[model samples]
Target: MSQATKTIQEINERIRKGTAVILTAEEMVDVVRAKGKSAAAREVDVVTTGTFSPMCSSGMLFNFGQEPPLIKASKVWLGNVPCHAGLAAVDAYLGCTEPSEDDPLNKVHPGRFLYGGGHVIEDLLRGKAVRLKCQAYGTDCYPRRELDKSVTLADLKSAELLNPRNCYQSYNVAVNTGSRVIYTYMGPLKPGMRNANYATAGQLSPLFNDPFLRTIGMGTKIWLGGGTGWVIGAGTQHNPKPQRNERGIPLTASGTLMLKGDMKGMSAKWVRGVSILGYGCSLSVGVGIPIPILDEEMAWFTGVSDADITMPVRDYGHDYPNGVNNVLAQPTFEELKSGEIAVNGQKVRTVPLTSYALSLEIAQELKAKIEKGEFLLTEAQDRIPSK
Candidate 1:
């Protein structure tokens, strides 16, 4: 194996001299394949990886300035969607899938909403007025029981795009093998694996590019919501001890990211809030990370390809919504991307839930910013544990 270390100074020097090269995670595959990992590592400075997918475990916090008459808000609504308002008066945390209490779906679809937290968030970003309602118990010295107002994103004291979980380290596949279609956060999964929805960016995923927490940790610079952001820490459910290949890459959902960005500075195109028909709301988040080429060993890991990665395709049939009780088939990403795979002795079609086009665009954008010196590489202030 190649040496597994390089100093920040040496990396910066080569970067400034243009001798340091950067490649998209996709491009690194061929570089490592053709020139070998060591040579590629010696020539590369950074590898930009990206993923654009709908993350259900995402939301934002907005601190609307205190309402008049000093109401200690006991309830709140944004575009008819209820938000967590247990904080100070006018403060709320909008969950992406939150639905309106009086949602028409309660009568029609029974468990769905036409406009949800995602729609409300986008409407706020568009400078549209949102109907706000709050109810507070009457109190002496405050003496307010109710308030109805129209609010915009600008009317807030602080609007933080705080997503509890933005990026999953690795995503394998979602399958439906029954005879009936099923609703899922991955969109509707047709029965019999008629389509397979794979969400990761494959070779261009950041965590997959750097499986070990060597360069990516707290305070790592990243492209988030179309602007510069930083990784706060390993997100919820992060399992660094998951199964790995010889290269130490996790074969399942092993790592994740906790991220925060300025809600005002974000673009709707990159950080879109979407509502899937027949399903709930979700955020289509765009994230990009630049992994440092510390040494040939690191570079080899960064260059891992889809062909080398494998994951189990579990049944998303009737039991999926409640639990995953069966494994249908295990296939490499390459096989899935081939548009077909075998499961239960039947050839099934494949699909992708994540947007590769958007992911590729984000990677390119970060690369340009880095090359122009507009974006600087970051050193992790806190390291992620492998255990």
Candidate 2:
């Protein structure tokens, strides 16, 4: 047996009428614990989840207005970072981790990235002036060979944040078991399993709350980088078949999302550039998703707590670099959040790469918007495939 079932339309109507009962994923855990899933499903209309982490697969797509000579750009650069100009005459895409040509990469100091595409994107969005240089081979129709100009985000015809993969349901915890320290995308790892690093909001993660991809799919509305965005489709390397618990939560890296949003509506606070010592540069993005409690099962899924979310630990010094998928151990988020985790009978200090406080703020902000009728639930057009 089940409680009364609600639809996206019904939730939207309640939101519009200012009668919607919205709660953050963290809050839903307590509500479901006290009242059970069935009662919570009938009482709660929406549950908001959020995550703030560095996503290397993010980038910006820009359509720069044409110049007078109508040059067809074959090579493009924003600031010092190279941008992909294969789409159209003036359209270009800037990848987040694309290092600058003059970055002095490893020449002077190893792994110290001074600037990159991620920084350039952040500069433009912050209303700072940026230099745009293009190179083109002379043609009969378009004769201009070289062009240079200064521009800002407001000067571009269009700027869109297009991420191929983000919001990983569960990611690997990185540790170093070798002799020397190793620098990785997971940050610097000390030798002899001295420290460990992990990234995720645990129970507050968007995909973790919707573990089965039932409500989060193509055309699903989400809060991305402080702006309303959409889940375009299944992201690259979206593995939904990973090992899971009875609650459907994955124990390792699993389901991912391809997100897109307009840069004009985004905020600098949520979209920022980051430089990793001994690694490279990447973009830190904030994403939030609102789940409509359509049934009792959905409510139960959203009530999952950090104590139930587990992550696989991997040795970054050797196994991870050599493409070995060997997992050291699986630890729950509750133990990881305790500031330490036991590996090989020794207590190792643990640190989080993602910001849980900020993630909670995003969830609370999203809940407030839904309660005020500023946001509404969207019916997913298609579900992401499992295979």
Candidate 3:
């Protein structure tokens, strides 16, 4: 059946009989290249893609439904990381890098604590107690003004991961050549292209596999935080209008995904809190998506190689993080991952902010779940951009 005609039930049936073939995103490339897209489409039933990296645009919502003397939590701290406690009396939104009260850039660059929202989440999953401290404006109805206590994951009535952005379609390679150390979300880059850091799953990423979001849109099935999740929307900076190459793949930064899932069901393995030297806190997340084979075109897209995907390597020493990002080198993920690349005729060391090995594991794990009729794929409820 064509992509327009294929149904979830039909693909699941094929998987049940062991006649349908499943391939990791890395393996799909060879299968499609050798057998051709048409042959690969008919033979491969699903392709599992994965990415494991620090996601800055991720956060969580915590609701303490059963707390005494309900107070409007004005300011909240969890595991020494301050949370956005302005939501309600008992609710808080803790982003991975929500700066502490004393984190003044002018005073102390890349300040201390080094842990924030993400660490709290991880510790909670590990069954460690989180120190919950908050101050509330005294109110007539909910009179409690302040609270200092320790709570566990079980203490929360509802904990959900509501990430506004995650899984960037692709990102720039970062380096510093301005004679000063540059601290960035990617990682710290030493001066003179001493180190280069890049983040992405390359070929084994969901949005990369489906550049146009043909089969992956709103409500797409995803492996989030070790459990099932759904694509809530297109991410914050999703640039559908980004410049693309001959293959229609973005040449610069592009799309991202909004994910939603229950926090209680998540595992510490798939979700982690990271401290990027001088860059503050971040959540090291593992995400996997299974693409259902419906047409030759779909198979072709899934097989797009790392060489086909391109990104700019930028000098991060300058200000205006996304702006004024001059291209230092244009390298494919293949070249970046080779442990070194030429920069001004000097071979520079390359470091990965995310774990490629973990990404492969996530993809393989998701594939096994689907092949065994454990994981389910959901059709998009609406287009991500609604365009």
Best-fitting candidate, scored by lDDT: 2
- Number of residue pairs clashing in candidate 3, backbone atoms closer than 3 angstroms, sequence gap of 3 or more or interchain: 1
Find the candidate with the highest TM-score and give its number: 2
Give candidate 1's error at residue 4 in angstroms: 5.1
For residues 1-387, write the lDDT of model 2, one tens digit per residue. 245499899999999999999999999999999999989999999999999999999999999888788888999999878999998888999999988878876568866887888888889879998899999987888788998999999999999999999999899999999999998899999999999999999989998898998889999999999999999999999996988898889878999999999998988899988888889999999999999999999999999999989999999999998999998988999999999998878789999999999999999999999988899889999999753
Could you give candidate 3's per-residue lDDT for residues 1-387 as a string of tens digits? 245435667887877776667899999999988999988887888899999999999888888763667688788887767888777678888887775554444246545435567787888988899778888887887788888889899888888888888888888888887888877777778998899888888999777888878778888889998988888889998888777777667877888889989888889999998877776778888889888877887888899888888888877887436578577777888888889888778888989887889999999999898878788677888786512
User: For candidate 2, what is the TM-score?
Assistant: 0.98
Report the C-alpha lDDT of model 1 over 162-207, residue by residue, as the tens digit.
Answer: 7777778776578886798877777778876787777788778788
Cα displacement (angstroms), candidate 1, residue 365, comes to 0.6
How far residue 49's Cα lies from its native spot in candidate 1, in Å, is: 1.0
Worst 10 residues of 2 by lDDT: 103-112
lDDT of 2 at 366: 97
Question: How far out, in Å, is residue 300 in model 3?
Answer: 0.3
- Which window of 10 residues has the lowest lDDT sum in candidate 3? 104-113
lDDT of each prediction vs. the true structure?
0.79, 0.92, 0.82
TM-score of each: 0.92, 0.98, 0.93
For lDDT, candidate 2 versus 3, the one ahead is 2
